[model samples]
Target chain A: MSDTRIIKKRYIFMASVFIGLALLLVILPEKSTSKQLKPEQLLLQINDNNRYVSTDEDARKIIAGDNYMQLIDVRSPGEYVEFHLKGAINIPIDSIFNKDKNGDYVYEDILNQDVKINVFYSNGTVYANQVWILLKRLNYKNNYVMKGGLNRWIETVIRPPKPSVTATVNEVALYNFRKAASMYFGGGSVAVPAEDNAPAPIIKKKPKQEEEGGC
Target chain B: MEEVKIQQNTPRKYMNPYLAGVLLGLVILFSFYLTREGLGASGAFKRGVAKVEQIIIPAHVNSEKSAFYHYVKNGEDPLKNRLVYMIIGVFIGGFLSGAINHRLKLKLEHSPKITSKTRAIAAVIGGAIFGIGSAFGRGCTSGAGLDGMAVLATSGFVVVGMIFGVGYLVAWFFRKLWI
Candidate 1:
């Protein structure tokens, strides 16, 4: 073929290839983890009790220093500064989607990963639930809302009402556990022995086998 | 047979710039899809420098005051990272592409107007300045220009504009080296 003919053929192929890639991108529309669920799918999960990690469980994780449990305080920065659960990382509700200085979504790796169960809490359920719904809609898994937020933590873990004399053995045992937790958190004087309780991991990881090594 | 001899004697024609650009865009898109990270070289180079510092002066890499300490802190090995592997792949791929095009050769490249020694010195100075600029910009051309633009990032567009804009604006001063 002539040089001009060869050049024309190459140009046409390049143009078509470029146009095809553009069309593919448009058609796919962010086929990544951008899995924005339909309202129906989201609604089905909104009422799912499993979305919540109870105050007791949250306290247990905190006390045990569970590596796989990441506590996120989803409140205003001022609220976070005033008080938050021990070891919680504060990501203000509004700034959850904002990227940090390094251009990564603020605490996004924790929100998106499965190795750790990200427990989000605020003053109440509203902010925490908002974060939960937002992350869930974006198809992020392994995130849970702390059922009653800081309010519940305060009520159950910080200052539990003493069990009545008629209370069951289990209720009495739970009260004693909370009493110990209150002391640990500097909210009570009674230094009761903490229960040897660690919340089970949300995700059951497969036992890691040793790698057979060779370069 | 005659055409084949001529082809062997000359470098192959370069790929069309538009086609190469589109391919690079696709590569960046796929990299994001698979790794959830941009394809950048400078960050990896930074990590490599951090590793070298650790090897040469272990104390310096561990010191909090040292800039490279960030990469080598807490017993973390930056050399074991994915970005480092990507850079290694880039070197091998570049060589392979050059060989395929019959452009593979080890020789000093200098403009006719400039001596080879001058070219070498200018390259070293230019590279050092570019390295400093990349550090300040948080990325080099490949990272900020191609990958950033691929994602429609504002920083990426700004970097690319600054690179060419500044290059053209200052080219007059460097014209003697080329012309």
Candidate 2:
């Protein structure tokens, strides 16, 4: 064949491959089919109504009680080791949809169609929210994210006296709120008398000093 | 005879834009299928910055004060990541494709209407802005925007629209940067 004809044939082949790829991208379903939520929509949802919990009242119950829900820590492995909810299993966010030895994600082992799975994060709830969205896309029902993440937990729950050198006062305030909120839910301290009539159930934690406590 | 000689000297043409775009989409899909992740570009840049910060301000980079310090302090080899490898693959792929199509050249690409200096300056400025924006938006064209969208991330579309909108809205003022 002439050089011009050879070039024309190559062009045709490349064009066909390109077209095929475009079609594939068009057809793939990366997100869920249910009413999709935009970042703006999610933000609006949080602001308009606190439909999402930073950490639910039942968190302590789950962590301590006999019949407990599985706690999945989606943060990095190191973060998981540094400090995480007691009894929570570490499944790094990166490894969530990742394949294993058989080249399949471990999602099936942790959950089935009926189970309720809760996720939380360190700072503002972006990563956990992302995972929540992913689970929704995968058609998993009853999956929820602990809003405000660990940041909210540290801010509201932990209330460790401000680490003077590292963070600012405002940062400390936020950290206190997050820390307090986490322990409020994770600690199972609902028995404290409510000062407000709104009746928000307070979480109570077993004293850390108490020896032989449940893991 | 002159026409034949002219054809012999001219470099091979670039792949059609539509074709290139489609191939890029497939590359993204293939990445998702194999690794359950999408293609990323700015992350590689961030890692590059992290490596630099490690050398210059080791303490600050390792401290909680800096946003990037957390990953480094985790004992995670920031470079030993799938995205980093994928980015290297992207460079190799782009260069190889360019070579096979005979479009490879050492010079910078710019519009005919702009001066080389202006183009170069714009490239640098654009790159820097892109670097910062990607960090905030959580990725750039390839990373957050495209990959996020392919995975059906709502934020992906938001960032993509914002980036393009901002680019177009400001493009008029920077007309001198490009034709």
Candidate 3:
């Protein structure tokens, strides 16, 4: 009879604990959770004051006229310097969640922004989407992620000509620039014409006659 | 006899629920402070599922149109991700707490009103539904809803409300399963 009573008491205690956990989950506020937005839903959430444009074309339009939209390149610092969209700021994906030396989340640099729209881009969707989710969790409702990343931009925006298994001088220069920029930035480089207006011309000269070899 | 051992084994007392909750909350805060993100569970499960799918149905894995599958394909080993690492931390945290409280055991907990078989079946069914719901909702209780709420996100609140609201609404029909 005593054992039975003890078992009954234990059961109640466990049940209450589980219920409390479940209740806690239910009651947690929306500020800390990742917002799982479908592509369409996220797009719809973007208003004129908070547009979430993905493509270079839209980015160009926004830069040309709309001063309110803030374009963010969520690639590496090196990638941003190479070739980013026009008027985009570079903030690496790793740095998106960076902590200080004391292991505290750097608050002021990340959350204090009073911007109209915050759009993020990366080499592809993964990093950008991660940033999008992070910002949404931080109560930054006016956030957007660029679709397809800079790879898509190179395909659809830059539209480089198909090479017949050989590189032209211009193509080589572009490729080298991209490689260097990616190294410098992190992944795909951002190339805003206003900032990186001139493609550094490759100075190619015929090799000097090998007089030393002849001698 | 084993059942007797389990019953006689003097179960450990657990931490006060409120204190445990506050500890969990601080863990979450520390995680965000260090990584600028919250804790997660379902992401690991999804990655595990994707890996299994990759092994059993390679063609289907290759053919999926979703970006998530693309990520799996692009040599980004899902198991090595931050979420996976965090889940490892969670297991350690949970086990440590359990061990400290003398709750480490492989026993099936159930209500007095249900048979062990019935409880097992309910557990499986509940898990399946929870898995599907997590996919649609983009995360589970810990990841999307609880952590999302801490940061004050609207979507977090919406999902938490919807999931619990549905759970309560249907709980009446499933009373036998729990009670």
Candidate 4:
């Protein structure tokens, strides 16, 4: 075949492939278009205030009390089964928008409750943040993320570090609260050794070099 | 024979690298805009492997014990994945690009210094190693390197740096194959 002829054939084949792709795109099921918040609005809401996010400390406080707070575990069921915060309802991230066997939206019942403060958490903040954003986009109120998720809970509440000798009264108080919280959460107290008894190391500041005059 | 000679002798014009780079950047940005995730290639290969494994050992592929079962356990078709579609689009795009430049040809590309057999063997080994590495890394060059870099992911920068660093380090020993 002539070079031009072969080129023409190839071009035709390429055109057909693109046309097929376009057809597929048109025919595929359209993604559910929920009334979502605009990017700018989301940014403003996420930044303007800490209303959309709850700290681990704040979450623990809520859990300790009889506050009407819904704790949603957004990790996989397997992970949820292994270990999760006490009283957290498991709802896999993938099934957040799915319907249950009874024809009701899986999360409709939980999300529709107006009184409870809905706080979502996962292994880390990423997935929880995603869920928070989605809920916020749908104009769902009282939605907050457990900041740093379970990871932060593990660090701050599960195994809180001891305050240094130079620590302020507030720091020591916070440490004590975390220690108590750890016990309440069933994370046995990590006996922080009395490192404060060690002698403070002497520090010598180096003499500052004279500044050179530039031309 | 005459057509073959003409085709071989005719050197095709290529797109400027900068222009190609800009176009690629635009595509990556668009992908990020549409989907929260970035482009990946190795995931598609993994899906393909999982699909084959499912056919041979349905029980093993379905079992929770297998590492691949995580991808298939949801009962979602592997081929229906976004990465699979993206890879298909990539193949078509590549063919169109090559065709437009008159660069499409039935031949194994290799350095002139190496025999075709040596090049083929090296290519297979390199690909196999890369496939294994990508699985561990959770993404390949385009996915982890380019997409990761675009998103300012630390893993993207680290992987790209390590890949090039190792490539440069080993290039000396493989000089005969290329130079």
For model 3, residues B18-58, the per-residue Cα lDDT tens digits are 66887888988998899777878888878777777777766
- lDDT against the true structure, per candidate, is 0.80, 0.64, 0.66, 0.74
lDDT of 2 at A14: 85
What's the ranking of the predictions by TM-score, best on top?
Answer: 1, 4, 2, 3
lDDT of 2 by residue, B1-179 (tens): 75674566556666678678878889889978997677787777677777788888878889888767644776666576666787788899889977665567789888898878888888898788777777777677877788877878888889889989988998899786566
Docking outcome class, model 3 = incorrect
TM-score of each: 0.60, 0.48, 0.46, 0.48
Per-residue CA lDDT of model 3 for A130-165, tens digit only, reads 777666645555567666776765654455334445
Ten-residue segment with the worst summed lDDT in candidate 3 chain A? A206-215
What DockQ, on C-alphas, does every prediction get? 0.02, 0.01, 0.01, 0.01
**Best candidate per DockQ, number?**
1
Candidate 4 lDDT (Cα, whole model)? 0.74
State the lDDT of candidate 1 residue by residue for A117-156, as single tens digits. Answer: 7899988899999999999888788899999987888889
Better of 2 and 3 by TM-score: 2
Task: Mark the regions of model 2 whose C-alpha exceeds 4 Å error after superposition.
Answer: A1-215, B1-9
Scored against the true structure, residue A175 in model 4 reaches a CA lDDT of: 87
Model 2 residue B173 lDDT score? 92
The most accurate candidate by lDDT is: 1
Task: Please write out the lDDT profile of model 4 over residues B86-177, one tens digit for every residue.
Answer: 88988998999787667778998889988899999999999999988887766888888888899888988998998999999999999988
Fraction of native contacts (fnat) of each candidate = 0.00, 0.00, 0.00, 0.00
